[model samples]
Target chain A: MIDQTALASAAALLGESWTPWLVVPPGLLLGLIFGAIPGLSVPIAMAVFLPVTVHLDFLSAVLFLTSIFTGGGFGAAIPAVLMNVPGSSSAVATTFDGHPMARQGRHSEALGLALAASCAGSALGYVILLLVVGWVADAVLLLGPLEMFAIAAWGLTLIAVLHEGSFIKALLAGLLGVMIGMIGMSARGDMRGTFDSLALVDGIPVVPALIGLFAASEMFRLMRRDYIVEDKELRRPAFSRILAGVGMALRHPLVVARGGLIGIGVGAIPGVGAAVANLLSYAETKRRAKDPSVFGKGEPRGVIASESANSSSEGGSIATLLALGIPGGSATAVMLGAFAMHNVTGGPRFISENLDLVYAIILGNFVQVVVLAVLGLGFLFFAASLVRVPLRYLIPGVLLLALLGCFSITGDMMGPITMVVFAGLGYWLREHGFPVAAVVIGLLLGPAAESELLRSMQVSGGDPAFLLQRPVATAVLLLLVASLFYPLLRRRRRA
Target chain B: MQGQRGSEVALLLLIAGFAIWLAQDAARRSFSFENLVLMVPVAGLILLLCGILAVAALRRAPQEAGGGLARVLGLLALLGGLVAGLETIGFDAAAFLFLLAATALLGERRPLVLLAYAGIMTFVIIMTLGFMLPYEMPTLLLDPPR
Candidate 1:
């Protein structure tokens, strides 16, 4: 079964100097730097570096990028724990408890738990991705418009659980986001909120808006505060305490499974990336917690749920990229440019025809996890230095960057100004006990869900019953309904 | 504070008006099955829903503590200033001032450090946008030229 040509090509790809293990440190450190900076995006990193892949072969470049991606996921925890600033969207959950834990003088233990969970979840996600690629391809393709609609609805339900305040308020926030999304045109060729001005045509760029809202708002909040992060000497969690996480991973297989599945599912969808995966995983993990009291309170499982899903989705994301030649998210979209640069052909047929070369890429994830684990543990031992960085230098520079980034992105003032408004809106919503997570979920899902729904409707000639006609779509719709009422149902049972 | 809530409600009303106007415009276009107007009513209804809910939320919790009116008002003022200043202050001037003002309002320890970073960031963004990846704009606003 070992084909000669495939193995030879695989060897040629991995045959570079330093092989797989050599580029690990540089890849990881660079990722840490990106994550350390609050507003720098992963897609930006991948896109900028894609040209470099032209000189190297596909396997080498992929290995480097994968290492960077994994490292970026781990590195985001640095700021999340330090300044309560999330360096990446995936690290939002980490900041919830990780910062609190740092304040409590338990940085080492918290970080150790984060690292171990990140590695375990990452490995689990990768394993699932590698084994289930073909099966997932078949399964995802079977999902019709109705099922996709249900999935979006389910994604929206995360607002209620994650916000943990009022379901009605969460629904309000999600609906507001959807309404905002309606500002742009639709798949059916209708202009919305255009106001006769060409400038308002495209509605809003989610990435820029997101960057402005979350990243800039954070800076604004920091500027408004006169606060100090008191330095604390923390206990170094022993190898046993950290390794004890493996059993937790094994014991709460559902958490690991849910995170991995969400990661893969989110990864398979174009444009939606690890950010959604992390949010979905966090919501699912919180919703499923038996005690239901541990999230946002330094629970080890919370870290595992988020980090695992973030890292796990990387492998699945790559499969989608390779098979469909469609970029799964921001980062991989950039990787596609790299693939084109290096003249590497990608698709489902690309793998079977060259199985060894494909396996080399898959096996490279194993290397990424190993590197992530070593670096993560090493950093955890001395996490105090990371926590010691002063916000004074970072705060102002970051604020400047936020505005500058916004203006520069649109090359106009409208974009930067939008950042201020969105940030204010975000702050306002937060004050009102509305979950920021719900709004983000709604904003991310709105256009995609609406367009897909519209397309499906048009395809079925405007038949509303078309949703229930398909079995997969029906099941997903039912699941969406369940996600909404499950808590109320449980409350009734208790009563 | 009472004034603050009133202004927000007014904005909601304005937005609802805009939504109604947009829906009317959409309805005038092709009403065929292919050019569906279904989402228009749906979207308008959602806006009205937002208007109702936002007014309700504002009413329900009149003075939920923390974050003063100055900060809130200053944020609104910043948005207005940025919109007014763009295209005339020529991005660098506007951006530098925007960061300077927003950062100052936010509570940074030293303005000098932030201003320096703002200057550098302004220069880079301008150089990149103007030189590296330039874009064309047809008068960001329709007002008479200076």
Candidate 2:
């Protein structure tokens, strides 16, 4: 599978140019800034910077863009650790343990673990892509609607795994999120709960709704506290502590490896990317642990699982974009635009013809990972200072930023309006001991689940027997069933 | 404890009620297979969960203390006001006023600190966001010279 000639050419091409290396730092910085903000995302940063790539060679352009992808993957975890605000949907699971750690005055360690896990995951993803880029298209082609629905069902099992207080309440919250996610128009041109509003036609915006549910609601809860870290002695950011955290992540090689594999697999699918990948990885990691109760309460392994999967998902997404000419998600979609700018099309033909370029792209990401580690340390050092700010000022300040960010998302009042409404719901849910994270997972997976199920139904003409024809889908569904009952079986055995 | 329990019950009912309303609306539209494939089953599950939760709430007494209701409500109102003010006064002025009010409500009594923090922070945020986003944000005081 390895192309020796192409590999040599790729090395020569990279070594020939000092220009591509220079763009890496600025691109990474741009992604970090965009990804660290609550409303903005990696795709947004790439979209904003796409025009600039026109001034450079194709190799330089892609390197710059991929560097942004690398940086943004880790950057999104920053706010999730410090403020219980996932900067993007992909970082939601990171907050499950990350924010709790922050509250416990271990914010620096959480940030460090996220950073190290992210770099390792990105490297692992690219290494896999480097080996399998030639065959990824054929593999991706086998996933039909039935299989996709099965995968989504597996993702939804996260709700059960994330249960904390009341299992009934968690189910209620998750189901409610599913209902909310289905509020817009159906696939068959039928409007369900639009309430005659034009904005509701597309559905509730996910980013703002999540920001409201997690960040704004958490801010309301933090009103009684003076600072994020209650202990004055633990509020300061220490470089040594961050290094310890990095060493800590390295100790758990199996968790990082499993998360990376899951990320790459899920991210390769179209319409599903890091958002589902992180949750599924976290669920699987928690499920397999000897004592699953340690999760979601400042567990470093939870942070590692979430961060690794989400970061590796970028490479998984890039695999689809490169091998099939299909944009895996919005970020890869923007990258397709960059490809067009340079008159380069992505597909089997592109891969076969420009194997050298493909190798160069994958190899460049490996280097980007190293640069990311160096830059991420500096970034974490500065971001870790957020715990020092008093909640009195930090609360309002972050809220204003979120409000403005939401406003920028929709260019109207709708974004902020949705955020405020969900903020109320989130606050009540949190106050009443419901798992807000379960609701978030439900919201993220609901539409995908519904649409995929509808597609499966249409394909099978409502016949349940069609499931037997697709062994993969049947196996996945069975796995989902097993996962659902495993916890109960484990508890029963322990008792 | 009673208040907490009451709030919990109300939330469950609210969710159950919303699910019913959505299902009814969908059925009213056409009850097509595509429209109800996911909704009907999900709505059924939500109602069942709501019943279970209401029972659970009644069985167990609330143990968590509640003292920050007023501050939380005040913050919520301030946020609501900021959203409302965004359209009337534009982002720049409205955001500035929100920071001022929010800090005051949160117990920042020093006038100079509040003014400086709100002014500088809002200006920096608005300016930074304005430069980064492509959309034309509505701003009263900070509108760029076009």
Instruction: Output the number of the DockQ-best candidate.
Output: 2
Q: Which one is best on lDDT?
A: 2
Task: Determine which window of 10 residues in candidate 1 chain A has minimal summed lDDT.
Answer: A227-236
DockQ for every model comes to 0.25, 0.84
Give residue A334's error in model 1 in angstroms.
2.0
Candidate 1 stretches with Cα past 4 Å from truth are A1-17, A76-114, A134-137, A228-253, A293-299, A377-393, A407-414, A463-469, B1-68, B71-146
What would the per-residue lDDT of candidate 2 be over residues A158-185, giving only the tens digit for each residue? 8888897667778888888899998888
lDDT of 2 by residue, B1-146 (tens): 47788888889889999999999998898777778988999999999888887888888877554998888888899899999988788888889999999999999999999999999998999888787778777899896432
**In terms of TM-score, which candidate is strongest?**
2
Positional deviation of residue A478's Cα in model 1 after best superposition, in angstroms = 3.1
Report the interface RMSD that candidate 1 achieves against the true structure, in angstroms.
4.1
